[model samples]
Target: MRTYWDLCVGFARTGVTGYGGGPSTIPLIEYEAVKKYKWMTEEEFGESLALANTLPGPIATKMAAYVGYKIKGPLGAFVAIMAHIVPSLIGMLGLLGVLYTFKSSAVVKGMINGVAPVVGVMLAVMAYQFFQKGRQGLGSKWMIGMSLFSLCVIEFLNLHPGFVIILFLTSAFVWSTYKESGKTLFTRKQVMRSREEEL
Candidate 1:
């Protein structure tokens, strides 16, 4: 019960503070679940993120459910998901009322304009963090090349991200399989020789 309450509170706070909707909430959710709570390892969190990205529903809610399930099973999942959603539900309702009332207010317009730049900066920071973390083994050259290639493919070619992901994964799978087969065929002789020597 205590665990459920704590999880609920944690996710509720995440929902309340998370700005700019689901995509924007990702970093905050990662921070709370992976860094603050130690509910999941970084690798586990990454896997959950990838899975959530592939699914249709709200990313933050999916993440919250996964982490909660990891901690306390189905009941925890219920608590965490409800916690994460409730704040957004309430806030959106209130925001809708305000927006309806102040639809033409200059102050609201100014506030929106002010927030846009801040949101841009936040997204930029998040992008930089993702790039730094993702480019660890590849080095800057490969990282930059991949980034440029992706941008060209997505922006210029107007390729769907799902297709790009499929193409990359298919290529990687073929290459990995080929490499493994070659290694297997060549390494058996060496292994046999080592075994004979041991005998």
Candidate 2:
């Protein structure tokens, strides 16, 4: 119960201060979910992030659902998801009302302009964090290759990010299975060779 409340508060803070956009908020979310709370490990969070990015809907909400499910099953998921969404919903409604009222206000325009660069900086920081994490997880060769592949697909080929994610996941699953099977076969061959030597 207490854990659930902490998660709610953590997500609420994420919702409140994630000014730039949801993608920009990802580093902060990872920090809270993986580092601060210890709810999940870095690898687990990375896997969840990849899975979330592949699926539709908001990244933040997907995070809330994943974290919620981790902690308290279905009910925890509900609480975390609601906590994350309610603030944004209220803020959007309030902002819409203000925008209508102050449509002609130069001050509002200046304020938005002022925040735009800050948002860009926030997004850059998040990108850097993710890059650092990827480097750590994937090591040098594969990291560079994967990053280059991603750049080519997204920039040159204009492939969807979701498609890329699916490819990555499928490749990882197949490689893991292959490696495991290879190890088992090698072990069996070694045993058979020892028996032949004995004969």
Candidate 3:
């Protein structure tokens, strides 16, 4: 149970050093959430990361808000959001004053080029971890099938992804509820097997 001030301080550090925008900043958020603060486990971070990507808006800010609300309340959310933006706001102001002075520097260009691969690797690692988390959940076989189906729908069928997201979410909720209630729907084939042996 951290205070609003704690949330502000913690999120502020990430906001200040979070270079390369939303996708790249994710790994930094993961470090703060899972490593430094232990606010969430690695698996929880992976799942939350996936959820954040699904929603609209900036990924880093979304994650920050989620974390703040989880630990505190709406006031903490406000504080966290403010802290996350302040650094970028201040940085931009400072940079604007000296923009022309450093814009053409070769060293600055080199630093940007160098950070690209690191950010890519971090995103790759996060993706892999999330993949593993998804593969381990209930209806995982259907999950695998849907992954391919989603790609086909997007690439070949040209369906909007929001529709697919809604479809899968609804189905998963229904499936999970049925499974949890011990009520089988598509278990006609298994009805006979249960009398003789468990499947």
Candidate 4:
């Protein structure tokens, strides 16, 4: 009911307002999911975004479907996908002729150029937020090290982004497990020392 409507409206806004494509729409989607409806926290959205990037196909569509499904299940997913793409589909159909007619017009070119910086700023802001969150959780040193390593691997070595994500995700999982085990062992040792003292 209300959940479904929210899904439709949120995704619709993203689909219609996003000018540049999948990447550009991410900030809009993040706002809707994190700030507007509170479907997920910023950290959850960041993780989901990373997971979505590792998959094939359109990122916005995938995000829309996932959020919808998370909120209201399969039916919500269908509604969300339709809501996200149908407006863009209709707009493209309606504007195809106009775009073709003004294909060489300077105004159209300028409009596109102007939008590029806005989209870039949106991406940069989201990235900075994610970096700040990471620093808080992992500390600045570990966060900086991982960021530099990832940048070098992807930019200099030309490694695939999906592989890098998988690598880091695995490392994080292993690190967490190791930390948990260490805590458990430390607790057990303390318990044993207490019993020995009592004896």
Best by TM-score: 4
TM-score, model 1 to reference: 0.83
Judged by whole-model lDDT over C-alpha atoms, candidate 2 comes out at: 0.85
**Model 1, range 1-199, lDDT digits (tens) per residue?**
7788779789998899777777777777878888888888776777677667666677888998888899999989989999999988898987998898997999988887887776677668767876775688568887788778888999999998767766765776898999999999889988999999999
Q: What would you estimate as the lDDT of candidate 3?
A: 0.80
| lDDT ranking, best first | 4, 2, 1, 3
lDDT of 1: 0.82
Off by over 4 Å in 4: none
Give the winner by TM-score: 2 or 4: 4
- Backbone clashes for every candidate come to 0, 0, 0, 0
TM-scores of all candidate predictions against the true structure: 0.83, 0.85, 0.74, 0.88
Residue-level lDDT of model 2, residues 43-88, one tens digit each, is 7887788779988998988998989899899998888888877898
C-alpha RMSD values across all candidates: 2.6, 2.3, 5.3, 2.0
Error of 4 at 135 (Å): 0.8
Q: What is the lDDT of residue 27 in candidate 4?
A: 96
lDDT per residue (tens digit) for residues 45-163 in model 3: 77776677678889889998888887776876778889888988998998886776887899878988998888789989977766677787746786678788998998899998777
Residues 95-129, candidate 4, lDDT per residue (tens digit)? 99999999899999999899899999999998899
Ranking 1 against 3 by lDDT, winner: 1
Which 10 residues in a row give candidate 3 its minimum summed lDDT? 180-189
